[model samples]
Target chain A: MRARDVVITGLGTAVAGAGGPETLLRGPVAGGDDPVTRLRGPGLRYKDRATRLALCAARDALADAGLPEALDAPEGTEGGGGPLVDGLRFGVVVSTNWGNVDTVCETSATIHRAGYTATSPMLLPNTASNVTASWVAITHGLRGANVTLCNGPTSGLDAVHWARTLIAAGRLDHALVIGVEPVNEPVRRLVGTGGPGLFDGAVSLVAEAAPAAAARGARPLARVGPYARRADPDAAVAAVRADEPAAPARWYVPEGRPAGGDTGPAGLPAHDLSLRWGRSSGALGVLQCVAGTAELARTGQAAALASAGGEGDDGAAALLLLAATAAGAGA
Target chain B: MNVLVTGMGAVSSVGGDARATFAALAQGRSGLAELRGFDRSRFRARHAYEIDDRPAPGTDVPLRATGWLLRAVAEALADAGLAGDLTGVPVLVGTTLRELRSVELNWCEGAPFDAARLHFGTALRERFGADRTYTVANACSASLYALGLGTDLLETGEADTVVVAGVDTITESTYGLLDRVYREAPESVRPFDRGRRGMLQGDGAAAVVLRRGPGAPAGARAYATVRGVGLNCDAYHPSAPDSGSIGRVMREAHRRAGIKPADVDLVLLHGTGTPLNDEAEARALGEVFAGVPRPPRMTAVKSMIGHTAGASGLHSLITAVQALHSGRVPPTLGLDEPIDEVAGFRLAREPVTERGMSLAQVDSFGFGGLNAVAVVEKVS
Candidate 1:
């Protein structure tokens, strides 16, 4: 199938000490304090730490997109103003490997220690991964289909790809794609300590259809190119390359992995997002995609983002092409 | 785009395979029994629809749920006539409690737990040689969402064949949460009934093999064609049902399928047996069919298997397809009093065998108000 034209209009991220899209590009800040204080709101206190982290990133993304702050108004209320986009047309997709694992363990402990009756009813929502995305939707009044994906590391990219598909299919006009992984004692003890690094927080991007975005006069950060996922990284890359013969100026590949042996005909320079941003289970792909979009918008250089597939990786290999300007304009 | 279901499988308390499960459903077999698998001494809800026996030829993976999923997948593969070597096929798994046993066992055994237990997709990939694996954790409706994703993959030509499954085991956390949050009848689940108290946790796994486009071989019969999928968020409360979203999703599924409410021959209600959920769903169905000539025949599968969590959606879908195939609507297991029935809709109390059911609709409402609906048509 031919790929449709989709654009990335906004980006928001909260990783390590970084708090927004701009901070994300510059890399993590020191101290690694959580942004809960900055992102607190009415219903946020009841949410788990992971959900709070995602909520902060999601709020930032909507704000960056120039959407109406009224979207954040509580349900059944009009605190802020009119909504920016039609609630039904706007959707959210969040990817997390171990969604709110911390809360799950805590609930289990409560059940064991104090008995089931002592467990908080409020904590029940946090145990599921979809609540992470649901909180964003509920807070933003996004009535569009909210989806939660758990495809390991590739979850972020897969989410982006799915969002792009929904827009291309005309199912949604705007989609919010986020990848989050919150640091918790339970996950650390399970996965074992030590890797390149572990960062908590989330990365969110706003994908909008060309016509809808143009109608709103939203400046495009980058035009999305052909995207594909396959078992073989080489095949996936080749298929994407075949769609866009022009080599990108730069490539953002996952750390510790290469895009097969070929660097395309141009042998474009490649950078590792994992090494630069530190390593974590989920949100790696979203971080790289966001970083690639940033580079394209700043330098007007076409960038290619590739994530190699692992044996058990939920996401196989995804080749996302981004251009500062539109790549297709055939009358 | 039309996606065909070439194969299907199930591992539930009622039966081991899809056929057996359907047979039991048709015969009105109730899987609800005393919760023997776990020590429910402290819990008020002592009875559940639990899978007591281990999967035949179980492994040492420490997670019974994972083993159940494997067995269901193998059965689905064999049913689809593609058993051996699933090298590059994309596999999508939807579940609520993924590998809960692994965590519980590890926590019980004390410190130094394997972190890999946290990643269910990776664990599934390692066990089953699927080139790509996707784990959907969107609560009760997760498996339905996975089915929708599989449909998207096929429609986009991303993959020729995709395997989608939903599996969830009875875990203490799930039981505890249900007991604490939505306590009704502590021992049984009676969906859509006036006496419906609350849902009983059920252990089950279900799988379906989807192929892109139309025209399966004449020899290999397709169960049904997945015509349209609708997904939407309530954006209301975390655990509360959003009647507006629920109605919209059902309408959206019909709209996507290029059909009206009248085209649906049957409706598989999410029907969790919770008072709020049942009332909301009933209201949504009424609003959706207010303009239709007649409402579809509706029944709740959870009445038989209890609430299967993530697998609940697929479990309902499987039952709907079988209902369409066999020209019968299985009785809703304890739905003697139909309090939530809408006008023009027939709630199944006895097995209703009506031929020529071309279209069926299945509803799945996950926790956090995640609503998903699928419209499937029999493709003869």
Candidate 2:
């Protein structure tokens, strides 16, 4: 099967912002107020914070994509079957470094302190990294290929890579890609010192095949292009440049580093979402991608995302290029 | 894209390697035993399938889980006849709990923290020197996801040879979580049996060396070809299996493999001995094979090896490959009386022989509604 062009059709954010994507692209979102606490659903009271955050972000992403609320039926629908997207064809891919770490820690602590019987069955499912993806699928009725990538900070990049691959393979027409992390005690402890920049948030984007986006009259946010991972940064940049010689107009690099010399177009305006959003580990890359897509949507230019330190000291790196599409013009 | 399984290795309770594990399965020996691998004084259900024949502690790696993975990788490499250094081979390891036990113990002891020692991906890269290493933590079906991802890596021209592994140690956290989640039966894990209790946790690791070809060289054998992969979520519940989704995934796998349900010769089930899962899976099998003239035979390995969590998928895949290679289906252990609803599908109560094997399916479903199915065929 020939590979089709994969485009981002929608965007949503639950990271430190109550107003969704706009608030995320703007400044801070009301002092890091958790969007999960505000989420409401059946049996949601028992769900952990991370699952709630993921669901809320998915809901917002579907709405942003002009799709109906996945969980809610339209007023005049019969048998409650009016959904904007095909549930079986729609998919979800989520990335998280320490998924529901707080729940795991607390559940283990409960068993240690109060005994095994005291551990809640409700909390057991959240212990796995894939549960957030599961909740998104279950709550939103996305029955297509569901996957969770846990490669630390670069996981979002991998998730996006896999999502596009699935769409290209014609397995799924659309995929909801999410990167989420919540500020929990365990994460704080693991990160050490309760780090100053550590924060919690979720980022979600709806990636669709070109034909599907065009048929739905959906506005394409950006055209995904040239994704590769390399052990050497020089090779990674070179590969990206070779794929698209124009070199991205904007860049998202690792925090605190001056972007130049093999990283991207020299002296092009660069931004670091990790620094502003606080290190969310797996969610960092998605935040960066969303920032880039937003930049492309806003400025009619392409953006490049690069990350160093793939597998500890292995010198592994990844570079992803996103160019603005005509449909995403003047957003 | 032809994905060849050139070599297979396993560090499981049934055996220290794939050969021994296959032998034990053929002999109908069970590996479920009382938990002695860790301190289990506070727990009510102490039985688990922990690897008893462990190599002595090594200085090069810190975590015992990593050691198991290294052993499996070495065996896989040697089995594949790959000599010299594998410096640039891509490695992907999947686990439900990625060194969380180390973190929990170290935190309890208030010891100095080193994330590399506990991070599975970093640990494997540091030990094996792979060019790229990734960790997949999608609960029980994670290794299947890794298998698909590894196959994708090969098909997409990322690497020629890829090492895919799945390992999870029986940690206190995992045990505690299971203990709270279900009622444990220490005597045995009996899937599809009327008197069955819940599943018993297991610890193990498996590695499969995959190459982008139809078969391997002389003397070195190719076990099977990964013909098709289909992974999806239940999208119904967090910990419960959805019958519709299960059937959909199986049909998808068959569709991708260019076969109908009737073409499947055998099935490796994710029969975890839980009532909810067993019934759901049975209904799914019935649904998918409803119109088939000859439904496939199904067997559960967890009944013998216990549920190995993330490693369960690869472990069962190795077993399925062995079945295809030997032309004999291993019996579903402890299934005294099979559940009537799925009886028409034919559970392998005893070792069954076949003249020649072709295609089989291995199913793995996880806690978070994560489901993966792979259709593998004996290289013709």
Candidate 3:
């Protein structure tokens, strides 16, 4: 089978105070609104916060991709059945660091305080590490390849890369990629509250085969480009540049590292979403990709580079995003 | 490009390494024993398949799973002739409850632990000097997903060598949850049995060194070539296995491997012994191999090792690879009265030793219907 070109067609954000992708481009805002209220149907009582956040972001991404009818059907409806694309061909890849910590901690604490009898059976399913990703797939009727990555620092980019790999391998024509982190009491206890910037939200995008996107008449937000991983940021950038030489007009750097300061390519106008939205850990890379998409939308025909991993990380990853027009013109 | 399994390692209740574990399976040795990791008096199900070799005190690795993972990876690397050096190789670790036992210990027993150890990347990097690490948490099927991802990495030239591993230590929280979910805890796990009660948790860690076939070091023997892996979500129920989807994924695996169902010689089942799961899997198998002239012989290693959760997939895969190499099909221990759903398929009640077996398929279905199936061909 021939390799397929992957493209980003839809973007969504469920970050607190950030209404949508446009708001995220400006800067992060602080608010206390409940992200669960954004959900469309019942069964929210048993879901954990992270799952609820992922569902909201998934809904927004599917709707943005012109598949609003693809979700929110009553439970037991096979494949979110509607007059749209086949849910079987649409998969989901979620990246989360502290995703189900609340449920895990709470359940374990209950068992510790009382006995095994004290825990709720309804909550048992949430203890599975892939609970958040499963919920998103269940709600949206996405029956394709479902994967949840908890890889450190580079997980968000890894999730996106996995989605692209799935599409390129003919496993799925479209994939819903999500990066989520919730900052509840459990997370605070797990990671400690010493850090000033703690992320608490979800970011999602729809990655589809270019041919599929065109067949569905979906407008491509950006073309998924070359991705490379190396021991450090400099080598990662150079590796990706070797694959695609187009100079990026903007750069989204990794967490705790300043843009263009010892990290990323020197002299490129870099943006760090962590400064605005707090350190998102695993979610930072996807958030950076979201920010890059927004930047490409603002500046017509341009390229954006998003790099993740730094100190305490195993390695660094660099991903390139080309504007739809630029990609079409073979830039 | 082919993804060949050049080396393998495993540590489970039955054995300390892959060959030992395979021997135990061939001898029909059961690992289920009285739970000793925690206070068993509080729960009805007092048995688990805990590893015999406990991590020594004051070990640099804080978590038991981490230690087991390091051991498994070291054995695999050495088996692949890459011992003491993992400079440019990428490591992918899959788990359901990574370091959660540490969290539970800290929360309940007031044990000290660093929070950063929750993810395995740092520990793996510091220990083996791996260039990159990815930790996948797709519930029980995580390791197979990681295997699939690693195969893609090699196929796409992302890495010359990749280590795919899975590890999990039994945790009180999971035990409690399972105890509550099961109405009555059976004395032993009996996969595909009519009177099967449910599954018991286990401790295990397994790893496989996958190298691009063309780039493999000279004189390195390949155990098996990973033909393909198919992954999918049921998107139906969180705990229930969907037979249709299971059949679809199996067919998908066959399609990706460019083989027919009849070509497969053996099947390593997920077979958790839960009534619903066994029945569902049987129905899916019946459907998938309905047209095959001679359906593959099926066996459930979980019947012997207990469900290792995240590590179960790799454990089953390693067992399958070993079976293909040795031409021995391990028995699904304690399967007294087979379920009616698997009427046509051959369920091994005793170890079957036969040569010339060329292909095998491994099935791992996790919680939330996260399913993965892999096709492996013996490298002669």
lDDT of 3 by residue, B331-368 (tens): 99998888899777788789889788889999999888
Shares of reference contacts reproduced by the candidates, in order, are 0.60, 0.53, 0.67
Count of backbone clashes, every candidate in sequence: 2, 0, 0
Query: A213-254, model 1: which lDDT tens digit per residue?
Result: 766777788877766666656566666778675567766665
Colliding residue pairs in candidate 2? none
Task: Please state the interface RMSD for every predicted structure, separated by commas.
Answer: 2.1, 2.0, 1.4
Q: What is the CA-based DockQ of model 3?
A: 0.66
DockQ of 1: 0.55
Candidate 2 per-residue C-alpha lDDT over B91-167 given as tens digits, one digit per residue, 9 for 90 to 100: 88878877766666554445455654444666565556565667778889989878877887777676788899998
What DockQ score does model 2 reach against the true complex? 0.52
Arranged by lDDT with the best first, the candidates are: 3, 1, 2
Q: What digit string (tens of lDDT, one per residue) describes model 3 on residues A1-331?
A: 0137888888888887887887776775556576667676677889888898888888888888776545436434643445446678889999998888787777777876787888888887788889998988887778898989887788899889889988887778889999999988878877776544688899999998888787767888888888876667778778777868678987888877843353345678767777778878788888988778876876774788898898567778889988777646222
Poorly placed runs, candidate 1 (over 4 Å): A1-3, A23-26, A72-84, A232-235, A256-268, A308-315, A326-331, B54-61, B111-114, B117-120, B123-128, B183-185, B217-219, B291-294, B340-344
- The positional error of residue B187 in candidate 2, measured at the CA in angstroms, is 2.9
Best model per DockQ: 3
What digit string (tens of lDDT, one per residue) describes model 2 on residues A12-75?
8887653656444455756666677668658886676677778877877888877666622343
